[model samples]
Target: MHATTAIVTGKPGKARPRGGMTKKRPVDWLLLALVVVGAVLVIAPFYLVLVNSFKSPVDYATSGPLALPETLDFGGIIKFWERVNFPEKVWNSILIAGVVSVLAVVISMLNAFAIGIGRIRGRSWIVLLFLMANLLPQEALLYPLYFMFKSVGLYDNVWAVIIVFTVIQAAFGTYLLSSVYGTFPKEILEAASLDGASRWQILWRVVFPISRPTLSVLLIFFFIWTWNEFLIPLTFLASNANQTVPVAISVLQGDRLMDVTTTSASALLGIIPTLIFFLIFQRTLTRGITAGAVK
Candidate 1:
């Protein structure tokens, strides 16, 4: 009363513009429509596989892939599982892919450390060599690798696949990681050096830890690549006991007459494990890729 106070009658709230709600630009709506269309296109094949996989052969033939299953059929799945010795194939794939991923990443990191951080002489030439290795098709080396493995009594062994893929994958990884490590922040290295960190200590505790996200992406890629490798694994892992999942799928079709439903069921089984793996590591892959975009 003494200071001429002003009374506020209405509740405080955000003021709307003179017009009603803002209208979205036409470009925005177009982009949204395009995204929806792209998503549908990408998802359609998986939808067909899933629907057909659960249908009986007769149901699949009658209604086609676009139609929903008349009844859920475990028959196709069970038949493929038993005939292919699916468990053994899965175990073999896991063993090979796991080993290759670790070995390839480690080998790549060491090579990258030397080339990028150590500043080895002729580093450009070395990188170029690795790049060339990637350009060479797998088919080109198949015969040589086949003979080499066969001569050493490692043929038909999971180790053969593991060893060959480790080298192949590491070549590309080294080419990639060298470029990444080359751009390492000098300030961080200087700080670590001032802290009395030896090169080995820095590699393990400082550099490796900082580079973990990129390495995780590489590890995931290596695992998936090795798991899906068909020709090399098919040739190297001859026995049913040693064959990987992809080899098993091919072998299944070659061994018997598979109806469309059975084939779809096998394809579905083959994809589920890899899809689960990708989903689990998806966040890590995204983070790794985006990490470089920011500071």
Candidate 2:
């Protein structure tokens, strides 16, 4: 019996039936192709910008837009950096976005904690007001904000941009985070309370730790939005010294039209910080967005 069993074990197993074995599907291949195409389309422009930044004007004009630079050239970037005072502009954007993101996320978290789980009176009304604020077009409030900032003498001030951006982003942040906070574990809250934690303590120690993922998403969004914003900075930060990266880059466009290569390099430089930030926080961002979407 042992010999017979060993003989059977040495024999190769029979192949699975055609029905039992899965075959590659045409639909799966098609979906994969589509995804690849979409990725190329999204990345193509950035790749062009990166390669052409090192190209000479002659190289850019004569070669196709997608063509690689014939020779490495740091001259264009160096020239652009010097001409626009790129360091100062980059710093301006960083300062404004950093402050706005931190302030906006904190403010949003406080508001969401109050209305979401606290079940304070008129919660519906409060949520409705936030929705309304989000619904209003930026253009609709453009002139009003402009005049208000001007009247208060905050125009052309970094803090002016920080304050306005914080308020605008905080409203939207609260709207999203309210969903997350509302769905927070009741068990955890009860445990915290029974542990003799005050509402403020629970909010800071318990809720904040749990909601870190949500906060990361909101902070990234606020930073990106504020960093890329053009219209508000264009209007409010009229002075060259106070201009953010977007506004500064626009000004560079006018001054450097004769040097398109340098202009391209400048654009690439201006966006590098944002790209690095997104790449660093991308996983957390995806998780936070999907987590917040849960019912």
Candidate 3:
């Protein structure tokens, strides 16, 4: 039986002497083509914007959308910066977004930690209330919030915007952090308790170390959301100096119309910080999602 099997296998090998080279399968080529097509579709718009940013206004309007620019021009960017008070706007945006992100994360972490790990009664009801708050539209609360802020003399202040953003962001952040904390092993927490560690120590030493990925993900998301927020800022911030980046960009549109080049430049500028942030925290974001999924 062994001899017969060997003879059958030998015949096929002898029939194809050069079988060492594995031929490209049809599916492999098809998948490669699909990937190439998808990449082109995703990249084309950015390429158009970048090329057009360097073109003259006439060229930008008349030239084919996909065409490369003949020469680079900084006129659009220069005009945008001068007209928009770009430096001051950037400073305001950074301060607002940075404070909001930090406050949101800190507040969410405390709320989630208390509800998840502390022996607190009515946790479920509290969590449910937060979830319900998220279900309500921001517009629905705007009138009440406006009156409250006005009464408190916070209407046009940065604090008003910060408080609103923090409150809005905390609900979702707490929900996500709570879900993540729930997946943590009770045994580990119990072990810490058995070791006579204080609650604060256990939280700082063990819980935080393990939850870094999730925290990083939440921080990035909150920063992006707060930085790009428009409606709340527009409604609450009455002064030009206090306007965030999104609000500033909206105000770029004049009575007649906006300058296409300047608008495009400002739009591009608005995305730069977010793009930089994503590049820095992309790995943490991936890890956070994967950790959550595994848990």
Candidate 4:
């Protein structure tokens, strides 16, 4: 009777679990949709501006906000370039931005390396001074700068704007690079030092390579800031030929403020280089900004 009465347990197989749920949450789809919508919203304005730049003034004025141009209007862009002395303005902007960015980065690297790596007695105080200098508003020093540049016969010169932009930008750049440098493993630096590597060698060979992303990011930022700077150039640069892109664009606004399309076209031209720069360094810039966010 015992052998005949075998028990038959009813346990679930691995294929048929107790709680079989294999669908994503509805909230996840909702969140993804929201993110897509937000991205579209953010991108739409830039798209409008860019597309509108290619439209004729009449087309731009009459067309729907999101409508594609029926035909390309290179004439408007050509007219804009001629009217604005676009090539000269672009050249001046490039030179100033390039020179200032390079000088700022070089100065920042040296200052950051010194303060970050060189065990100076008053390193903290030096860094604090830089922070304080960055805190000082440009407007507050404008008058003094104007007077000093005038005294030195540098007012209304490209060099004056270049020097001012470089100096002002260097403060922030130094602080940023120093923060990045501070995050580097000290043990690595010590090991390099023990291997008979000189300070310069370590900087060039060890630190610089690792810091490329941050440096590229800073370079792009400095270039954009310098290129778009208006007040400084307006104050120091008196000639159209010497004016940077921002100043040139501002002059366009003053001269043709009523002509919305021309002004918009000039604005678009001014923005092109910056957009190109971002397109070139987008990845490094993103990494640079997010470098220390996690750790």
Candidate 5:
């Protein structure tokens, strides 16, 4: 008789014959296939962008987007770079995104502290109002903002875009941070109070340190969102010198007839800095997300 060995199933008195093979579940395969498909969908665009960026116009025309380039061509990239005055546009984007990220996070923290920790009357309603404000379409506010900024002589300036995004971003940040802060441990707050720590001291020294991970997540998000903003920046930053990367690209695309390769080069250039920024902060993002998930 063939000997049957037992396999422990991590339960008391629960064992299966080692000789028995576990049947592969159709559902597991299906889920894996779905994940692979999702990954492909997400990666395909970046692949296309990278591939075409190195192709010359002639090569692109001869061989479609999917085909490998005949040679590494820098001409298209160089042309796009010089045509748009790319460094200035990049600087504009970095400045706007960086400033907005910091300001928005600070504003959100203060707002969340009031609504969440303070437990003020009608705090729920206030949070709901902020959420409603976030839902308000930017299109509806465009003309009023335009008029206001123009009157204040802030139109066609990077600061105009910065200030606009700071408020807009802060609305969502406040809503999110409030929810996070609402669940903060009362014991900790009480202990801090007992220690004679002022509200200001508790906020800066205690709450801020504990919430740093979430704040870092918010900061990265705000920067990326502000970087990618197109409509408001295009409208407010009318001058070429003041335009962000997205605005510069749109302007170039609209004003000139760009071949596939050059257009791809422009897109690649536009996204590279943002990609680098994300890479640098990717560890922080991962740690923050993991930390936030734990209690």
Candidate 6:
């Protein structure tokens, strides 16, 4: 019997055992090559900055931008970091982005929750208003805010920038959260209501906790947006002390110094937080950013 079984198992025409694994489809290497090429193109600028940031200024100017540095250089990095007071600039950006993120999330959550739950008489109209408001370009809104902030003596203050960005993000945030909440199982919310949970309690305890991933994505987006906000901060904040990293870097690179290597180092430093945020919370971002981005 054992010999017969072995002969059957080894038969040339017999189907092979899967060993508990699903059969994989043949890989499309052409598609893979295209994707790899696209990824390289997207990452190329940052890669160039990283490599060239280490080259000496003279070497950088003399050599091809794409070539690897012949000798490592730290002097430019140190000088730029100190001259720009990079740490202070970083701190300023963090403070602005942090505050903006929190405020935007809170405002967005409340507005979305109200709109999503349909507790209002004109819910659709309210949502439409928000969507319309969001559609207005920043440039269209900028001058009015510039005038308002200037009138209130908040024009040069970081708070001015913070307020503008928070409000802008809040509109989008509301749209995002409302879409998510609209899909909630009605029975669960009904059950919570039957259990004597107040609307506020339901929102804070049940909905908020459940939507942490979404909120996290919003926060990350807000941080990145405000962190790299250049034109607003540049126009509003004229002083070196008030400038965020992007504005600071731009000002330092004006035609006077013309120091390419140090400017690259500064830019690299400015973007470190953005990179770190992406690396750490990439999975979380995927869940919310995509949904929010689409509509």
Best by lDDT: 5
Q: For model 1, how many clashes?
A: 0
Clashing pairs in 6: none
Better of 2 and 3 by lDDT: 2
Best by TM-score: 5
Please report the TM-score between candidate 1 and the true structure.
Answer: 0.89
| Candidate 4 global lDDT | 0.81
Taking all chains together, each candidate's TM-score versus the true structure is 0.89, 0.88, 0.85, 0.82, 0.93, 0.86
Ranking by lDDT: 5, 1, 2, 6, 4, 3
Distance from true position, residue 219, model 2, in Å?
A: 1.3
Model 4 Cα lDDT, one tens digit per residue, 208-262: 8878777887899999888888887888888777887888777777873336556
Give the Cα lDDT of each candidate.
0.89, 0.86, 0.81, 0.81, 0.93, 0.84
Query: If both were scored by TM-score, which would come out higher, candidate 3 or candidate 5?
Result: 5
Runs of candidate 1 with Cα error greater than 4 angstroms are 1-30
lDDT of 2 by residue, 98-118 (tens): 999999999999999999989
Instruction: Give the Å shift of residue 263 in candidate 2.
Output: 2.4
Better of 2 and 6 by TM-score: 2
In the range 218-247, model 6's lDDT, one tens digit per residue, is 898899988988988887887778889998
Higher-lDDT candidate of 3 and 6: 6
Q: Candidate 5 lDDT, tens digit per residue, 46-119?
A: 99999999998888889999999999999889989999899999999999999999999999999999999999
| Local accuracy of candidate 3 as per-residue lDDT tens digits, 1-295 | 5566568786423333275766779998999999999999998767766766666777677775567766777777787777778788888777888888889888888888888877369878888888997899889989999999999999999999889889988998888787667667889999999999888988988998888778878888898888888888899998888887788788885624565666667777777877887898899899988986776
